[model samples]
Target: MSIAQIIGSRHVLAVQNLHASINYYIDQLGFSLVWQIEGWALVQRDSISIMLGECQDDISAHETNNHSYFAYIEVTDIDSLHQEFTHNNVEFVSQLATKDWGQREFAIKTIDGHRIMFGQELLF
Candidate 1:
């Protein structure tokens, strides 16, 4: 079987405020702490992981397009995740909607302005 060639991938993000960024990932975004060094941290949510590193300049998620080149999390249940985030007052770049490409998706911004888009495949 030709499975996904990519076994796993981690996005190393630049974070100006390490602790606060860690807190936002852990507390707000529901990611659990994996481990941390003085200037870096690792957090995970299910199968996905992120590496946050302390930096002088953390770039914005988007430079031109409405959204591009950001982390895309393929989840099992998009509606439930959306509801949970909504209840927690998490900011969203857009509401949950099925795109022409046949995936239901939504996007959110992290404390350091990193954008994460969550999606679920449409069987239909």
Candidate 2:
């Protein structure tokens, strides 16, 4: 029997307001709304998809400290992506920097406080 390979992933996030989070992801982050109904929404950009669920009673991601980090997205053109986010006024947790571990990366915080890191492998 052949083993199946794991495919893609969608990060699920608990947000305080579904509408606002959806707008932020689309307008600021350049994601397109895949679909939305009631308290749930799905947004996508390139190969990344994020599922936003409204949970008013749950703790916000900002309150989770380091646990708030949800995804590390790998991309090819790191510099251009960083510039695009900057122009859109996306709230950044960290600016683009080449790490000693051999990656050029940056992090941003969604309106819901979920953090996502975008990185590209540094070809030394």
User: Lowest-scoring 10 consecutive residues by lDDT in candidate 2?
Assistant: 5-14
Q: How many steric overlaps does candidate 1 have?
A: 0
Clashes in predicted model 2? 0
TM-score winner: 2
Candidate 2 versus the native: TM-score?
Answer: 0.95
Clashes of each: 0, 0
Residue 44 CA error for candidate 2 (Å)? 0.5
lDDT of each: 0.84, 0.94
| TM-score, one value per model | 0.85, 0.95
lDDT, candidate 2, at 34:
97
lDDT of 2 by residue, 1-124 (tens): 9999989889888999999999999999999999999899999999999999999999999999899998999999999999999999999999999999999999999887889999999889
